[model samples]
Each structure stands twice: as C-alpha cells, then as structure tokens.
Target: MYTDSATYNALLDGFCKCGQIDEAFMLFKSFRDDGFKVGIRGFSCMIDGLIRSKRIGEAEKLFQKVFDVGLVPDLILYSIMIRGLSESRRLEDATNMFRDMIGKGIVPDTQCYNMLIKGFCDVGLLDEARSLKLEISQHDQFPNTCTYTILICGLCRNGLLGEAQQIFNDMEKLGCSPSAVTFNALIDGLCKDGKLEEAHLMLYKMEIGKNPSLFLRLSQSADPILDSASLQKMVENFVDSGLILKAYKLLMQLADSGVVPNINTYNTLINGMCRAGQVNRALRLSEELQLKGHFPDSVTYSTLIEGLQRVDREGDAYKLFEQMTENGCKPNSSVYKTLLSWSCRRRKTTVAFGIWLKYLRSLAGHDGEALKLTEEFFQKGDMEKALRSLLEMESKLADFDSAPYSIWLVGLCQADRVEEALKTFSILEEFNVVVSAPGCVKLIHALCSGGKLDKAVDIFLYTMEKGYRLMPRVCNSVLQVLLDSKDNTILAFELLDKMKSMGYDLNSYLHRRTKSLLQHHYSLRKMENVAAR
Candidate 1:
C-alpha cells in the first residue's frame, strides 16, 4: 500500500512503452488521487504513447494539462510536443511551440530540427524545410546523415532532382557521409526522371565506398563498382527504361570485378530479358547465373517460366518449372498461375489439370499434422475430439483454398467444362474470393469458344465489375465470337460500347470487324423485311 513516486513513474513509463496508454493514464490518475506528485517524465511518456497511438487530440489535451498543473514544460517535453504535432501534420501549431521553446532560450538540436524539416518536406513546403536546415547551422548544430537524407528524399519526391543532388553534394562536402538511404533516394529520383545512365553511375560511385576523391574519379572513369542492393535496383531501372543491353553490360562488368551479383540482381536481369522477349537470352542468363554460384530463386524461375510461355515455348517452360522444384525451390502461387494461364490459353487442358493437381499436392503437406490428429481421434472413438481436429484441418486448408480453386477453374474452362468452372467460380464469389485476371480471361475464352455468347458476356461484365482488367486478346475473342453470327451483331455492338465506356482500347481490327458485321446484319435484316412485305 506504500508506493513511492519513483515506482509510480516506472509503472507509468512501462505501461506507456508497451502501448498500454490507457493503463498508464489510469496509473497516473490513481497516483494523483493518492496525493502523489507525477513528474514531467511520467507526463512525457503518456504524451508520447498517445501520439504514437495516433490519438493526437488526446495528446494535445494531456499536454495542455501539463501547464494547468503549474509545471513549466522542459526542453524534452517541448521536443515531444513539437514532434507529435509535426507528425500529425499540424505544422503551424508545431512551429508555434518550437518558437515558444526558442523564446525560452532552448536551442533546437539536430534531431528536433530534422523532425520539423521532415514535416515541412512531407507537406511540400520545401522552401520552409530548407530554411529550417539552414537554421540548424545557425544553432551551431551541423546537420547529421539523417538530416541530409531527409532533405534528399523530400527533394526527390517533389521531382526536384537537381536540388536534391546539390544537397547530396553539399552533404559530402561538409564531411557528412551519405548513407545508403541517401544514395537510394537520389538514385530512385534519377531512375524515375529517365536518367538511367546517371543512376547507374551514381550506383557505381556508391559501391566504391565513400571517398571524395574516388567519387570524383569514378564520375569520369568507366570502371564499374558493386553494391548489391543499389546495383540490383539500378538494373531494374535500366530494364524498365528498355536499356536491357546496358544493364547486361553493367552486370558483365560487375562479374569481371570479382563481385558476383546476388540472386536478386540476376532475377532482375532475367525478368528484364524475359519482358524484352529475349527468352533465349534470359534462359542463357539463368544458366550463367547458376554457373556463377547464384542459383535461381522462385522469382527467377517464375519470371523465366512466364517468359517462355509468352513465346509459346511451353515444353521448355514446363521443364524449367520441374527444374525449379527439383532444385529445392518451391513453386509459388505465381508459378502455378502462370502455368495454368498458359495451358488454359493454349487449350492444353491436360497440362493445366496436371499443374493444378501438383499445386494441390504441394498444399497437402501443410495440413498433414491436423489430418493425423483427426485420424488418431477417430481411431480412439473420441468423436468430439475428432470433430475438433477436423475443424482445425479445415481452417488450415482454407488458407490454401482460393488460389488452387481458381487454378482448377481455369483448367476446367480449358477442358470446355464451362458450367463446372462457372459453378466453382460462383462458390468462390460466395466466399468473396477474387479469381485471378488470367482465370477470368480463360473462362471468357472458353465460353466464347463454346458459343455461349450470353454466358461469355456475363463473365466478361462480371470480370470488369470486379476491377479485373482482362487482356485485349480475351476482349477481341468475345467480339469475334459475337460477330461470327449475324444474329449477335447487336450484342457485339453493345459489348463494344460497354468496353469503350469502361476505357478498354478498341484496336483497328476489332473496329473493322464490328463495322463489317453491323453492315451485313442490317442488310440482311432489310432484305428479310422487304421479303415479308
């Protein structure tokens, strides 16, 4: 029953630190009710916890309480209040508090200034942020790595790459070593601004370590440097910019530097090559990376498999997929989806079915323990326990349910089993499971192929309603199917109109076919009417 002030303070601090703000406040209230004095540390903990929990209004109220209790807010308390306000985007209130602190002869440290600068930058007040950065020096506190990085990131976000780079240069000139975050920000800005070469060069400089003289020489030198993470990002940027060849050359140069690219770097290059339609080159790179002691990850194999499928090299893709599994790299949902989509698209129903079966088998191991428990309970004649075990198995199996069903649905559609796929799809819909876009595409294709125009249109409309963008191929297929019959010309026109309203691009061939079909339908209708008369 005898609690000391330090004990109460410790209890309050612990509760606040663990995100139990309510409990901390209750303790504070209890101590106050017991005529015990709660110090500024207790108040600081409460305020910080409230702010962190996003209860900014409550934090503000507690802060005002500090003054009501006749306690002069110290620099630490002021810093906490200022930071909370800044983070809450109440920049004006934060600035006023900051000024009040300064009026009390409290100089802001680098961290305090950085927080304010970050707040300004977050709201696109770059001018104000820069002014604050200057004020840090006026306070005789040099901006640290974090301060420079924040400004760089802010400038990059605002598309002020030039200003950002200048700050980066100034940061280095002031003997502040730029961190990985700083380099990443500047490099990301360069990449986004279509300055791939400069991004690459910057990455090279980053890898050579932080020597000013070396940075200068590297700028003019053709020698490549290696930083796995940053270089991996730059490789992606290059590929995105259609500079695959340049990215490849950079990778080759990195290889010559005796620094092997990581699996991620190889994956990026492999993905880029695949997207560029150089599947052969991508396959070769896969082999090359493996020879260099970097085996293909799930991502590498998935990217390569998808690429091969795009080029109609299903056999090679399937082989690579098997290799992926054989090499102890598990095929992810993406791999299964890719294989299913291609098999369905190409009408290789058997192949699609096999892939789906394999996916199901892969998931079988996940619920093995639960299944064993269920079997054991059943053997023991404990029906209640067996039922509970079965429920556990069901819950575990639910996690793997949606994806496999979508895959199987695609396979079913490919086998011309439209009704069954639709039934499965409806069950998914009831459970709020969204079929993948490819699954939608395959279903529509199968419906169109089966001359189920009404059903195809229904699926097409539903797919779009679900915000799934079907490929243009499926769109064209639906149109062609409708246009194949003179009777469905009006339906084709209506679907085209719907597609246009939905912002689907209408290719010229589709336009020509629709117009020709419309003309023929109208002419035939006109002739039929005349004959009737």
Candidate 2:
C-alpha cells in the first residue's frame, strides 16, 4: 500500500543529504527489518549518513555488511568509505581499499583521489602527495582549485614554504588565476611563516577589490561569523605575530562597524593594552566597558591584577581580587595560581600558602583532589591532625579519580623523601593518574641531587620511553652523575646522541658543560701520553 522501495529509499537518501541522520538511519533500519528491498544505493546512503555523523566505526561495520550481502561497492560507496577511513587517520587501510577498487576496474572519481591525496598531505607525506598530483596531471584531469588549495595549505602548515609556493606557481603556469581561496591560503601561510608584511599586503589587495569571505570561510563552525568577528580574529593573528598597531586598527574597525563590545571583547582589548604596558589605557577601557553596561568579568579583573602584580602593585592586585568577588564573580583556578605565583616571586611563602589554602578549601563536590592536596600540605607540620581531617572528608565523599596522588607526589618531592616520592609515583600509576613530564622532572631532579642517581636515571629512561621531554636542569643532573666515571661518560654521550636523534638540540648550556668536561678528560689522556714519550 506504501510507495515502492526506490521511492522510500530516495526519500531517505534526501534526508541523509540534508543532515537528518537519525531519521535516515531509522528509516533504513525499518526498511531492512520489514523485508523491503534495500539496494546498493540504500546501503550507500546509510553508510554516507553514518560517516557524515562522524560514526566512522559504524560506517565501516555497515560497509562490511554490504560486502557480506554480496553488493559490489560502487565508486560513490568506495569514495565515501575511503573518506571515512582517511578522515579518521586509517590511511593505510584507505590506500589498500582504494588500490583494491582499482583492481576491480572501479577507477576512483576526482573527489576520491583528492580525499586520498589530502589525507597523505594531512599526515605530512608531502612527496607521496605530490606524486598523486603528478598522476592526476598525467591523466589529463589535474585536481581542481580545491585540491591545489588543500595541498598548498597542507604544505604550508608543515612549514614547507618552498614546496607550497612552487605548487602555487605551478597553478599560475597552468593558467588558473588564483581565486580568493588561493589568496587566503597564501596569506595564512605567510602569516604562519612570520611574513606579516606580505600577509598584510595580500589582505590589503582583498580590501581594495573583492573583500572575499575566504579567510572566514576557511574557519570552521564554532568560529565567529560576522565581519567584526573575522576582523577581530585577523587582529588576534596580527597581535600574536607581534603586530600591535594592526590589532589596534582592527579594534577601532569593530567600534566603527557599530559592533557593541561585550565583556569578552573588551577584556581582549584590555589584555592587549596591559601586555603593551599601557595600564592606564587598559584601566580606562575597563571603566568604559562598565559604563557601557558591559561589566568586567573575572578575566578582566585577572588581567588587571596581573598587570598590577607585574608593576610591583601587590596591594592593588589584592584589592582587584576582592573587588572581583564583591562583583558576584568567584575567582577561577587561574586567579589563585596567579596570586600564589606573584607571592612566590616576592618570597611571600606565607601569603602564597594562604592563597593556596583559600583556593583549596573553596572546593566542594568533584574537588576531592584539591582538598586531598591541601591535606597533604598541612601534613608536613601536623600529620596526625591533617590525616584525621582528610580521613573524615574521605568517609563522606571518596572518589578514586580525585585521590591525592599528584598532591602527595609533589609533597614527597618537596620534603626530599626519595623513598616516599618513588612510593607516591608507583601509587599514582595504581590510580591511573597521568603524571606530566614537569612533575616527573621535578621528582627525578630532586632524587638525582640526593645521590639517588641510579633511581633517577631509571625514571628518566622510563620518561623518555614514554615520549616525555626532560627539563634541561633534570637532564643535566642525570648527565652529571653519569659522567662521574669513564664508562658512565661514554653512556652519557650515547644518551645525549639519542636525545639529539629524537630532535632535541644538545647545544644547551648544561649539555655543552658536560661535553667540555668530557673533552677536558680526553685532553688529560693525550697530555699523559706525551709525558710517557
């Protein structure tokens, strides 16, 4: 009584194309379970739907199901399948499947080829990617503007400016006048390469002519859409590249465009001003934003507080912190971190500890780690009393995720208790807490200084295997111990060579000092040989 299967499948396919993924899947499932004839198109539509929804694994399962049901995967099907795999970084499987498709006499379409080439470029396989482009050109269907743009952008992103520009030049020789997209890509590449003047020149040309939305278009959704927003982003890019006047002009443009500056927008401007050491202008903007009914948020206060702290205005920072709370805005982790950092800089340990405790005690639900950390800090002076308080809190709300592993690790390291630090490090592994490189470095450095060189070296090797970069200070400490003997000195050199091979420059001051000492030993040996002669 209902429309035929093709008609229904067509309707479902349309639904998928329009982003109604849930509805399409439901319809497809209903068609299958009800014994309706679901053809290759139906299967492909469902697979495409799943891929578009970012359900790549599910799409892969569906593709296998299609093969199991004896449906020959078509070009569109293979293209979509390859796309899903490529986007998820399963490039090897994608390449194999694509080759298999070619063997089946199903030559890939332009989009499919582009997808594979782009995937290779994404993972920095530039030479292989260029080969694909050459293949496309030989086939008399050289990739389109989008394909060239993607390749250029990818090459530029990988810092292969020479290759990127060569591709662009090839495009020109091919008689393809550069579009707005091409221009934007080049400008962005220039910006990345610190050629702000060139980027600005390109941007200036766009202003005098098309004023294309390509730059804004390149930015994905969740990015600001309006002209002002795009201009603001451009300003941010320039500012990040140390182009202050460029940012200022763009900020003024936002005002001229009648875009009402919100708290965040104002905060950004004030932060820029504060960074330039124009505290008076930043504060003036803060008051201006407030008068315009856009009151300063915690960030605004934090920014000013940081500025005050920078200029030795600790009293002013405290006042701003109090004012922020009075304005019904609670301080964030950053605010307390900044305050404590300032206190530490001024050697005000008591003030730092006070701020730390206030930040710790303010925690409630989902703050077990902070509370436990506070307990550990208090433990050094009063362990029995602190443990009792911590145990009581643990009884009420205990979550394994919020255990004081990091806190105890830090506390143990600070107390110079190597045994306890190692124990805490092991305990952290038991809790599945990811200890960062800095945390491990601090511990290893402390252990090395305490003559626990073997233990420290073990930890450093483990950290290195885990792809963690050791701090120079920690590496130097380990190197010092390893260079105490001739055999150890050779081992130290081997380790340094390994580090260099891993892309760490061993030309650091500490590394050079160790090298000089080793060289001195070699000179002493040569001098001894001459004396014997």
Candidate 3:
C-alpha cells in the first residue's frame, strides 16, 4: 500500500538523505520487482546515495542503466550527475556532460553553472573559472551571489587580492548586494594576505563578530537548515566517541549535502574499521575505493592484510597481496617485510621464499625479469650465460646492491669460473658494493683453487682489515693454500696465531696438518744447511 509514488519517493529520500543505503537499495529493488512505477526520483535517490557513499563508479553505471531502460535525463538528473562528478574531482567529465546537455537544447540553470565554477575554483583553476564567469555574464545568464563569492575566494586564495577586491566592489555595482559570506570572503582574503589591519577594518564596518565560524557564516542557499561544516563536526564528534557507524552516516550526510571528503578521510575510516576487528568491512571499503577509480595504496592493502591475518585468514591475505600487485600499487619495504615475517611465523617455506624473492625484486627496482634470468641461469649450471646476463643487466642499473652481486659471485665460485669471478669482484669493488661474508669466502676459495694463492691472500688481508666475518672454513681454506706453498710458511704461522686469537681450536686436524707441514719443511731446510756446513 505504501509503494505508491509519493510514499516511495519519501521513503527513498529519507533513506538516502540520512545514509541508509542498504535499506534504500533493498526497497529500490523491491519496488521495481513489485511492479510499482519507480519514477525519476527513484533513480535520483539511488545515484545520490551511491555518490554520497563514495561509490561513484556504481552511481555512474546506475545512471546509464536508467537511460537503457528508455528514460531520458531531465534538468534535475543532469544537474545531479554534473554536481556529483564535479565534486568528485572529475572536472573535465562534468564540463563535457555540460556541453552534451547544452547540445540537446537543455538550458543549464544558474545552479549548474555555480557547481562547475565552484569545482574549478576548488582546484585553483581561477583563469578557467573567470572565463566561464565572463561567458555566463555575456549571456542572459546572471552570476548569482555565490558565483561572485566563489571567484573572489579563488582569486584571494591564489594571492590575487587586487583582483579579488575588484570583484568584491563589482558585486554591489552588478546589483548583487554582498552577503555576510561575501564580506567574510574579502576579510579572510585580506587577513590571509597579511593585511590584518584592513581585515579588522572590514570586519568592524560589517559589524560582524571577530570570530569567523561564530559569525558571518555562509549557509547553503538551497538547504539553509544545516551547513556542511556543522554536519562534518557532528561526524567528527561521533568518530571521536568510537561510534564509527554513526560517524560514517553523518559523513554521508555531508557528502549528500555536496561536500566530498578527501582521501585522508577515507583512509581514517578504513583504518578505524580494521582496528575495530571489522576486517571484512574494511576490505569492502577497498573495493568501493577501486570502484570509484581510486586504487588502494600500500598502506591500504597492508592494513587489510594484517587484519586478515589477525582473523586467521592467511589465505585471503596472500590473495590480497597478489591482487595488490596486479592492481599496480607497488608495495613498499614494510609491506614485504611484514608479509615475509608472516610467512615465516606460519612456517610456510614456499610463501616465505616467494615473499623473499618479491622483497629482493623490490630492492632491485622492478628488475624482476633480469634478476630471475640471472638466478635461473646460475641454477641451471650455465655460468658463462649467467655472467653475461648479470653484466648486461648491470649496465642499465643506476644503483648497485649486494644481493644480486652475491648471487653472481656464488654462481661463479660453484661453477669454478675463477677468472670471471675476479672481474665481477672488481666491478663490485669499483661500485663500493659490500659483499656478504659467505660471498667473500666463496670468491677467496675459488681464487686459491685456481692457482691464484697470492690473489686469495690479498682478499684475506683486505677482509681482515674491513672486519669481514671470517668463518672457520675461510681460515681453514686460507691455511691449506699457505701450507701447500713452502715459501708461505711464515704467513701460515701468522694466520694460525690470528686464528688462536679468534678462539679457533688450534688443535683441530686441519691446524695440526698445517703445523706438521711447516715443521717438516723447517727440518728439511736444517738438514740441508748442516750438510753444507
């Protein structure tokens, strides 16, 4: 019985105006399915609801769907979409739609022009706003008081106070008396321009309060009951009191009143949702952001991932991480580091390795292709090809990091390609890349085995001076090299002394063998010397 046009519009208006979207949409669907004539107001209410909820993409689709159902857009509908689009920062789209509306012979009222001009002014496009003002003035269309205030506000904000003052003076000459808002605009402009005395004089002449928000306040001409700032303040109070749902509703009311919240506001709400253990709700907000042509950044995705993990939904977290990359929002170090730790805590080896590779790739500046190729070639026992690819890739990299270089040196050592390893070491040194302890050991061992004992000793000396971590294996390997060369007896003794100082068990088999070799050489030299005597 209440599904009649008057009741339907009233219910939908009440629902949409107060931010009851779920019930509004439900009723909208039921009204249609029940064969009631859902008039133009139905579409208008739904679109307004979506826009206020920041579901701009869905609102756009609903508008098209209305047209597809054989309905044409009238002035009110066109004005709504234009206002929605312009307020959402799609200025060009709003302008193009305005042109389309005009081509169809629908004359835009002053309200429509005011919306676009306000949009232009908001984005600091004063020149474009002035031109539009001129065009409208030349036509039969008259600029309202709001239009003049918008231009004056924009000019003053852009630091063109002289022009703003001229526009303020012209307001009276053009037959539109300055409202309190108009005077406030000029006074605020003067104060912002460091003309406090002038601003005080203006305020005194206007007989308004010294405080701006307290007196000379501007109310929406169409809806003079509550201003957007009051609505926003109400929402803030609700949010501060931990009434998230209520705060969200009031925020929507502000949006319905034509004040779009900024990105920081959306982030705040999403973060609050996650903290309140409403992870799924936060995830839904992420989808709404995307639907509005706004992609979630690393923080957005990371918050949701952490929330999902807390709720024991690791699988969902991984999927979101993958989806985040697919959407082209690059992850920062904190994101991968968090994910890597998450994988480790879960004892998921594959996940940890995958995240580690991703982390390294991020550090490599999106050079995943080259990095993967180099690692793959090294794993496949193709040392020459790996070295070639690494060199080629290095030519294009503006910055050098240690991970890729360590992988190259490890591959070279494993394949016994000692010469190329030395050249790569030189390149790393030239760029001041700090190879890890494992990498230093691998290269030194390779050099000694390739009959480059002196080269190995030189690296060992440098590693010692640089305080590189010398594993027992590194000392053992250097000792073996020195023991094999009779002329290096003194160096071997010195290395053993250093090892003893570093808490190495000098009584180990390798150390004993080294000592035995040196003692045997000394005895042979003494016997030869006695025979000569």
Candidate 4:
C-alpha cells in the first residue's frame, strides 16, 4: 500500500508538523539524492510547519523556491501556502498568493475566500472583509452557512452586534441555519456590552428555540409526523423540566393548530410572559389558565408581583401582594426585596427601611443579613465591616451594583489603605462604573495628607483622563502639599498654570502666597547657581 515516495513524504510531513525542520530537510535531501522528482507535498508541509513555528521568513523563502522553479502546485499546496501567510498576519503576501492562484489558472474555492476574509477580520479590516463577500457574490458564488457564521462572529467580536444580527438574519433568509457557535457569538457580544437582559433573552432563545420535542425537532427531517400521545408526552416533558420558554412557544403553535394547552403548559407560558415584561399578556394568560383549571400558584403570584413592579404599577402590585397573602401564600425574601427595591426606587426610603426592618429578624443568618449588615455598618462608620458585607452580597448577585464601588473606595482611603484604594478605583474604572466625584476626591485628599503626592498625582491624572475635573479647592490643597512636601517647583508652577487655564480662581490670600512662594523659590535657585559659579 505504500510506495517509497509515499512513505518518505509521510515521514517528511510528520517531521515538519512536529517542527523538526533539520530532519525533514535531511529526508528531503535523501529524496533528492535518490532521484525522486521534487514533491509539492513536502514543500507545503514545510511551509505550514514553519508558519506554525512563527518562522514565516523561512516559509516565504520556501514558497519563493517553489514559485520561482515554475512548479505546478496543486490546490492543496496553494491553499496551504495561502493559509500559512494569512495566519502569519502577512496580509499582503496572502493577497499576492491569492492572485497568484488565479494567474496560475487554479480556481479558488470557499476555503480560500474564508481564509482571506478571516485574515482581514483578524486585523480589524472589516470593510475589506465585507468587500470580499461582495466580490464572491460577483463571482456568482453565494456565501454558504460557514461564510455567514464566520462574518457574524467576526462582526460581533469587533463590537458590531447590530451588523452581526443583520448578517445573521441574512443567513436565515438565505436558508442558512445557525449553529450553536453562531448564536453564542451574539450572546457573548451582548454580555460584553453589559446588556445582561438582552443576553438572557438570547440564552432563552438558544435553549427553548432549539430544544423542541421529538416531532417538532424532527419536522425538518424525512418523517415529520408523530402520534397525539407522543406530542402530549413531549409537551409534558418540556413543562416538567422548567423549559418554560420552549413550552410556551410550542403551546402557542399548538393553539393555532386547534390543540389547547394543558394547565402546566399554560402556567409555563404565563411565567415566561411575566419574565419578558409582557405583564398584560401574563394577566390574560392567567385568566385563560384559570379557565383551563390551572389555579395560580405562589410562583405565579411572585412573577406577577415582579412584572407589576417592573412596569411601575405599585398600587396593583400591593393589591396582588394582599391577594397572595389572603390566599395563604407566604411572602418570601425575594418578594420582600423586590417590594423594598421598588419602594426605594420610588423614593419611599421610609417604607423601604420599614420593609427591611420587618424582614430583618425573620431572615436571621440568611442572605438578607448581608444587606442589613451593610446598612448598619455604613451608618455606624464601620466601613471595613460594610465593605465585607457588600462583598458577601456580591458573592450571591453577579450583577450586583447596589452602591457605587466608590463607597468602599472612600472607606479604604479613610483607613489609609492607599494601594488598596487605588486598586479598587482601577477596578471600578475598568468596569465603566460611575463613581462619585466626592468619594474620588476624598481618596485624593487622603493620599495628599499622607504625603503620598506621587500616588495622588496618579489618581488625579487618571480621573482627569476620565473627564472628572479637579475642584479648585482640591487643586489648592494639592498645590499646598506640593510646595511643602515636594521639591519639584517646576511641576508646582506647571500645576499653577494648569489651574489658571482651568479657570480655578484662587482666593486673594492663597494667590499672594503662591506668587510669593514661587518668587522665593526662584530667588533661592538663582543664589545656588551663583554660589556654584
């Protein structure tokens, strides 16, 4: 089964793949000495291995050797050479090789197009990548599903989620089905953009849209029919597993086809409707659920409560709250937290505090204890304790942004934990968190007071870069610190000029003092120069 040439080629390729170039060349020389015609496969293998090893120069030279000798390379060789160049980020070389393929009358295929497009995308040349898509269309080759998936993923990675979605829609319209990887790109993009709710919806779609029952799942296959019992069992399984979104979609489809949904299916639909902020739809579904003998449970009431709160229907929320209690459904901490948060959002701090107080003793040694402890510690100036309590809260709620991280920043400053304070501020900035200017200023002042002027300057410059202007009073205090603690008078004077440019009008006394201090500094410098002379 193995000719000597075939065996030698395989061995050479294995050496190249493993980056053993010297042995591969020795084998190549052995082939040449044995009078075998130069193998294109051996050349392609070496090119790829060199590229993978980041030795693009050597690959390029080998490519030139093949090209210069007018060796008629096959499609695999051409594709391999182009891929190596693309992966090496040598875009121009890849382009030339692409052209060379055409000039050599070798017809390029979809993989070649994909490689070039992916190369452009990797280098942030999206317009070029799109232009190639149009070029491919001009060649009368419509993009396949992989092409669309590649473009969609590339656009999303570049923060062009809208464009990615447009392409995704185009893919669907063109009869190109989306794979899990394609959907995940958009989900990941939404998460990166901090659109957590949108991300959740996409996840809902991925889960429920794709995980249909047997008949529905097989609708695209050769046999698309199932018995009534099988369909009912499928719906029941979806409902049992809490796949509410899928169950709701399937139930609605079933309704259109004259099959009324069961109670469990209706409840699932109602819950999904509430979560999607279609509270009115949920209400209608609730009425229909009861008509179907599906009594609303505690989950239904809780979902409705949240839905009502989301829509700012506080009066209706309370009415439902009373209704749930009268029906003997005990209110849980989640329900109370939702109520307290809504009340607090409405500026009813007193009512919110009342709600918290009412629940405090009931939730002893539970999650609610952290919120209570944070409140108590903050009010009592026990910032360290407050910060720890907040960390505990964050451990449970991934999207927790109850208070500005600036609160802990101020506490860290007051505790003279300068390094910790700066690190915390950096974390807040990295997340694009809106910190209070007063708290940042407090940190700066604390640093200045501690005579860590260099660190203070770092924070000041960082804040200025973030568009937070330094207060005139703070500037004056920093200037005082600079004059007293640091010997860099030129930097002090530069700061004075910056203050003037920023329109921070100094008081008359501080004005005279700064001018007088600068004059004295200059005179002292001049005297030192004369003494050296």
In the range 1-533, model 3's lDDT, one tens digit per residue, is 22369888988876665445656887787667445767788899888877765678988998998878888888888888888998898999999998899889888888888889989999999888888887785447999898998888888888899998898878778888776777888898898889999999988867643334421242543323254455545545555676877666545444433555554555666766665556677788777766655678878887777666544566888799899889897877556655655554454433444554556566645566887997787667665566566656664566544564565566567667688778878776765677667667878888888878777777776676567757544576587678778777667777667656655566652545556676787798799999999
User: All predictions: root-mean-square deviation over Cα?
Assistant: 25.6, 23.8, 27.2, 23.3
Clashes of 1: 0
As a TM-score, model 1 comes out at 0.43
Error of 3 at 438 (Å): 66
Of models 2 and 3, which has the larger lDDT? 3
The C-alpha TM-scores of every prediction are: 0.43, 0.42, 0.41, 0.39
Q: Poorest 10 consecutive residues of model 4 by lDDT?
A: 223-232
The TM-score measured for candidate 4 stands at 0.39
Residue pairs in clash, model 2: none
Off by over 4 Å in 3: 137-139, 208-533
In candidate 3, residue 27 scores what lDDT? 77
Model 1 off-target regions past 4 Å? Answer: 1-226, 258-260, 368-407, 430-432, 436-445, 448-451, 464-533
* For model 3, the run of ten residues with the poorest summed lDDT: 209-218
Evaluate residue 59 in candidate 4 and report its C-alpha lDDT on the 0 to 100 scale. Answer: 77
Candidates 1 and 4, the one with greater TM-score = 1
Top candidate (lDDT): 1
After superposing candidate 4 on the true structure, give the runs of residues whose Cα lies further than 4 Å from its correct spot.
68-70, 208-533
lDDT by residue for model 4 (88-137), tens: 78889898988888888887777778888888888888898898877776
Q: RMSD (Cα, Å) of candidate 3?
A: 27.2
Clashing pairs in 4: none
